[model samples]
Target: MNFQHKTVIITGAANGIGEAIAYGYAKEGARVVLADIDEEKGKYLEEQLRKGSYEAYFKKTD
Candidate 1:
């Protein structure tokens, strides 16, 4: 549960369970990489996380 300084990669993270998991990791101070085909949603989530001071990035999987 201690994810401090860890790096996590989550696929299909534009929405649903994957997004939840990504945010969970970010909340735990882990670096989160979100991969999905939905670029707009992925970018939006990434921006939201960044604004909240969480380390996160979005990558297109397709």
Candidate 2:
């Protein structure tokens, strides 16, 4: 489905399943918000997604 203009928030998104879901939504044109305590990895993934022209953001949380 077209997720353009949609927003998806994923927890534990610094790696594994959560990261996978984040990419899936982003690829489908959804804006992805990644919530994780791992700031480095979370930020890295956000940058990677942005480089690929996807809308993504990282929020450090417990």
Candidate 3:
């Protein structure tokens, strides 16, 4: 399935299942939005995705 131009929002994406889902969507060419309380981890993952040429962003949420 082509995921180009698709968007996926994942909550609690700083670690575990959520984090995995974030990477999965990114690998599929989707723009992933990672929302979590762990800002450090979220930002780190966002940077990693960007470095890998994936579209991703992190948003801090409680």
Candidate 4:
């Protein structure tokens, strides 16, 4: 549960279950890498996480 210096790469992270998981990782202090085809949602989530001071990045992936 201690993800102080860990990185979590999650696919389909733009919404639904994956989005929830991404938030979970961020809450646990992990650097979250969101990989998804939905650029808009991914970027939006990225911004939201970053706004909360969590390390988050969004990558467009197919």
- Which stretches of model 1 miss by more than 4 angstroms? none
| Residue pairs with backbone atoms closer than 3 Å in model 4 (clashes) | none
For residues 26-61, write the lDDT of model 4, one tens digit per residue: 999999999999999999999999999999999999
RMSD per model, one decimal: 0.7, 0.5, 0.7, 0.4
Candidate 4 structure, TM-score to reference: 0.98
How many angstroms is residue 32 displaced in model 1 relative to the true structure, after the best TM-score fit?
0.2
lDDT of 1 at 16: 96
- lDDT for 56 in candidate 1 is 92
Worst 10 residues of 2 by lDDT: 18-27
lDDT of each: 0.94, 0.97, 0.94, 0.98
Candidate 3 lDDT, 12-53, residue by residue in tens: 999999999998989999999999999999999999999999
Error of 4 at 58 (Å): 0.2
Give the per-residue lDDT digits (tens) of candidate 1, residues 1-62. Answer: 88998999999998999999998999888999999999999999999999999999899998
Q: After superposition, how far is residue 53 of candidate 1 from its true place, in Å?
A: 0.2
User: Which stretches in model 4 have alpha-carbon errors above 4 Å?
Assistant: none
Q: Estimate each model's TM-score.
A: 0.95, 0.97, 0.95, 0.98
Residue 23's lDDT within candidate 2 is 93
For model 3, the superposed segments whose C-alpha errors exceed 4 Å read: none
